[model samples]
Target: MPAQTGLRPLNMKHGWPALALLPLAALSSIFNWNPAIILVLNITSIIFLSQAITASSVELAAHLGELQGALLSATLGNTVELTAGIVALVHGQIPFAQSVMVGSILSDILLVFGCCLVTASYNKDVLGFNNALAKTLSSLMMITAVTMLLPTALYASFPIAEINKKVLLFSRGTSLVLLLLYGGYLYFYLGTHNYLFISDNAETDSDEDDEPSSPLANRAKLALSVTRLIAAVVATIFCTEIVIENTSDMADTLGVTEVFIAIFFLPIASNSTEGVHVIAASRTGDTDSAIRVIIDSLLQIGLFVIPFLVVIGWCVAEPMTLFFDSFQTVAMFLAILVVNHLLRDGQYAYIHGAMLLALYCSLVVVMYAR
Candidate 1:
């Protein structure tokens, strides 16, 4: 049996602190506490639950083979964002949900990846990864950017009443196409060319760390891991609903636009664990794994989650379009361009990371002002 390469078992030291926040969050929500208090508590709790989901999902995915396990882990990793987006949509907060979709991709590529690069390059002048993998991911992101651009362009060039139906139809059709493209990307990633993505160090480590276990014990562990994953996901849904319910109130209290909150805060809270994981991987000198995590996350949001949300919106009669606001569309394009440019040579330095973080901060300031 191969050892679980990127998967980490749950750590009680970190888990208990976050788990302790859950009851407080529940009580705050139940007692009609201040919206800010409720928001903080619930968002913190959701972040913790998201971590729990990741840890348990990793354990469960370990039971499956490498490619299948990687796929499962990637899908499960976005559960928090997906759950939060759906909850927002169900409440008819279309703009809020859309902001989240955009923010997630930006945060992953610019913010999270930036932090990873900074960490990896702290003692070293240059950090490097697989150039082929970087280029492939970048090309896919460019395709996603184009998909996003077309709808926004269509909506912008026409009258609202005349273009609204057309935009929705185009979004739905384009979403289906993007979803298929995502499927093909997955097949390419996990089936045909998986060796390109997997790091030699990870394979060597797995082989060295492989240990024997009885079949019955493995089954028991798998069952336990699955149960924990399900429980964490359920808890996350509950906490996410609480957070969404209070989001508007919190925004009003803070005197910030709800779009600002959605773009800046929600993505950070939802993706905190994954961000930390990326940084950790980079710190351990596993630049390949860290880069993969960052790119995989960006691709998943762009190709899978956003399109999936559009289809879901159609079913719910919410008419979610791919037409992001002009600012958001530009931000997405610029973020992708910056990341792709930096990674073109498969090398990065702390200065590159700092530049990305600076860009992210500038976007935050602009969004906040808007």
Candidate 2:
């Protein structure tokens, strides 16, 4: 548990920014501060919340075994985005919710992965990861893209009468299939092929002497971990609600489409936890773990979060559909294509990272223009 080191002297190197900003953010929202100020606070708050979430996830991972821990962390890490999407859905922000789903996929593959690769490239000209792992994840993501495309294609091909009703049924059926696929993936990765994700060499070497041997100390650590996890989640929910509520006004103020907000800002905010985790991994030369984190988050977004949102919408009287706009479908497919090309050789370079970033920026510009 992280509590064992609770009293350890604070390192100025990596202080918790979220812990500091959260109070101001909360107060700003409650006090009806300036919209620009509130917007900045909200953005900063989410970033900090994401950092806290990542911290708790690391502690939780220490308690659970690696594979289970990683999976749990990834799922928990995504909870903020999932929760926000649901809120948007129930509020009749279907386009917003859909944009979040697509944005998460794009950001995780292009933005987060690019950042990690850039970080890794800083130390060495080129870094290598396990090809088998990369290939397997890429294949799964590509299949996911195909599944997503199916519903939209079906909707387009059919007659337009009762279009919403048709889409609702198609989405529900598709959601079930996606949910099953996600379950199978969890079983495969966590139960059968868990060994593949685990690294023989630990990323960081810690002296045994650094850890307190007392059982009481261990228990305290566990309790602290649980507390932090709970607090981070609670705080995240509050801040996310504020952000979601204010998002439209903010977008209008900034003279951009809500899709621009969802595609670029929201994903970056929601996926901040994974972004932090992956970049740290890359910095420590844990390229394999970094890549895996990026891929797994993408998988979670496509398979679990999207389907979960659809089902949640159905229950909440807001029937969400998988029938994304043409732009979204093309963006997702292109993002996957870029990821496949970059990861196929099991190598990472700054140039490739820059290219990925460029592509993401281009998409953002196009979205803003729309």
Candidate 3:
């Protein structure tokens, strides 16, 4: 086994103490605490819960290989966003849910990826990853673009009412196909083609002597990790609901559209956990992990979350089609294009990161102007 380089420290000093805010948030909810204070507590609680999940999952991932580790991290990290979207859908906030899905995709690809790239730039002039894997993920996103754009295109073509059976059936059918695709993707990536995602430079160091923790300690850590995972999830569910409600109130107070809030603010709050990990990976010069974080999140949203949302909407008696506005569809396509351009070279630089951030900001401005 090649000598392994240690990853950079996570700089988690400030994050740990934020866990104190969780009880305060719950108390505020119970006691009718000041709305502003409650909001702050809730936000802090969410941040703490997310980081808690991330921290535990990373520990958990130490036992799993890179592929499984990244998948686990992405899945757990996305839970908050998924829960929030489902809650919003059940409340008949369909547009908000849809906007969040769109925003998540954009945020993962542009905002998260760009920021991680910049953090990486501080350590190296250029970072590279497995281009073949990136190309595969990019191709998947392009397919997703077509699938999402179909309902809107059909709506425009037929002049059917939005609530018509045709739209519903079309959405249901498309969602099923997407769900199948997601299943197939899992089998392919985790089963047949797993090697594509695993880097050649990876080091394997499994000497028995190198094991630092005792068996009892290891078991205790595992137990604690599982306990924290459940607690964080429960806490996150409550905090996410509070976040959604308070964010809506905040938006109304600020006179911004709920769509705007859903697109920009909600995604940032929900995605902050994964964003932190991505940046940390970049800072540690683990470009593979950073790319995996961004790309895996995007894949989960496109292949899994959107299809799941369609089904959840139907279950909640508020059916959601795969329809996105033309503008949003265009933005998605543009995002894919930009991502392809960046990843095609198999190298990343500060300038590339800057361009991505600039593009994401421009998209935000356009959405706001709309």
Candidate 4:
């Protein structure tokens, strides 16, 4: 029950660029055009589609109540990451998929959250959010970081083929545990203790802005929003497939590792929509919702998307695991540490934002040099 803001009408202008590129990307994919060209077209198209998905999710969320709306937004917001990860795994791109999971979490918590802080703190010396919720989310993030660390440590401790047999089993077992934890979390927050998260000011403001409308009109709007959301998701799935198919070629052409592209480029496109939504919430002086959006998304990716992927891979014979490389595991741990430390007081400033951005940039450089 985070603060609910007035629903801004879905902005089609933000999606115009994507609409213009949709046909070209489809044609490029169908005609088997240059891999780099296809990759670029599809990547750009996915970014635009991501924006549309976010806009529609926001509109749809307005029709639903706070708890259901938050769930819907979090699910739809991670659509790109989930879709891309599944497609990559199906194609046997394990490292790429792994990087996507790590990258999406990192980008949301560090890059996107950083931007939100900078924007929210621009006119003010500091901004604050719900301290209790922030601490809870930070604690969950610490658990996720630990989950990531264990598998990597296991892999390092037993590098022999004999010990390799236990890694996937361990990862699968951990995935099931993580999935259960996420379910408990949803029940805890959205069911038993939702009142703790709801903001009275947001509820009052939203009620003030509410306008009476006919049941028929409300139905029509809901129908349109659902249709728009479904359409964007389908379009994103198509573009993501195209992009995944060409990722290797694009990496080869650019002379970079697929892990590098997955970490740096893929997350930007996949998470751009969420980033925009977070920033908008911050700008509207709803820092609570803004922080919720970022933390919720990160939790969704860590607790839901990653485990879901691993489970899906288990079913699909892809044998995906939570065992990320040493560098990625360490980076994720450090990121969660930094974010938790900065957010412990539930306050942020421009300098805090700059620190996160600087760390992100440094990580990028290190990855490139690796």
Q: Of the candidates shown, which would achieve the greatest lDDT relative to the real structure? A: 4
Best by TM-score: 1
Candidate 3 residue 99 Cα shift, in angstroms, is: 1.6
- Writing each residue's lDDT as its tens digit, candidate 4 over 158-224 gives 8587556788899889999999998788877778977656666557766787989899999998898
After best superposition, candidate 2 residue 244: deviation in angstroms?
1.3
Off-target runs (Cα >4 Å) in candidate 4 are 1-10, 13-17, 62-71, 156-159
TM-score of each: 0.93, 0.88, 0.85, 0.91
lDDT (CA) for every model shown? 0.80, 0.76, 0.73, 0.80
Which should have the higher lDDT, number 1 or number 4? 4
lDDT of 1 by residue, 262-352 (tens): 7877788877887877787777788777777778788888888899999999899898889888889999998998888877877788888
Cα RMSD of all models vs. native, in order, equals 2.4, 4.0, 4.0, 2.5
Comparing 3 with 4 on lDDT, the higher-scoring candidate is 4
Give the range of the ten consecutive residues with the poorest summed lDDT in model 4.
1-10
How much is the lDDT of residue 210 in candidate 1?
86
Report clash pairs, candidate 1: none
- Which residue pairs in model 3 clash with each other? none
Candidate order by TM-score, decreasing, is 1, 4, 2, 3
What's the distance in Å from true for residue 54, model 1? 1.1
TM-score of 3: 0.85
Cα distance off (Å), candidate 1, residue 202: 1.1
Error of 4 at 22 (Å): 0.7
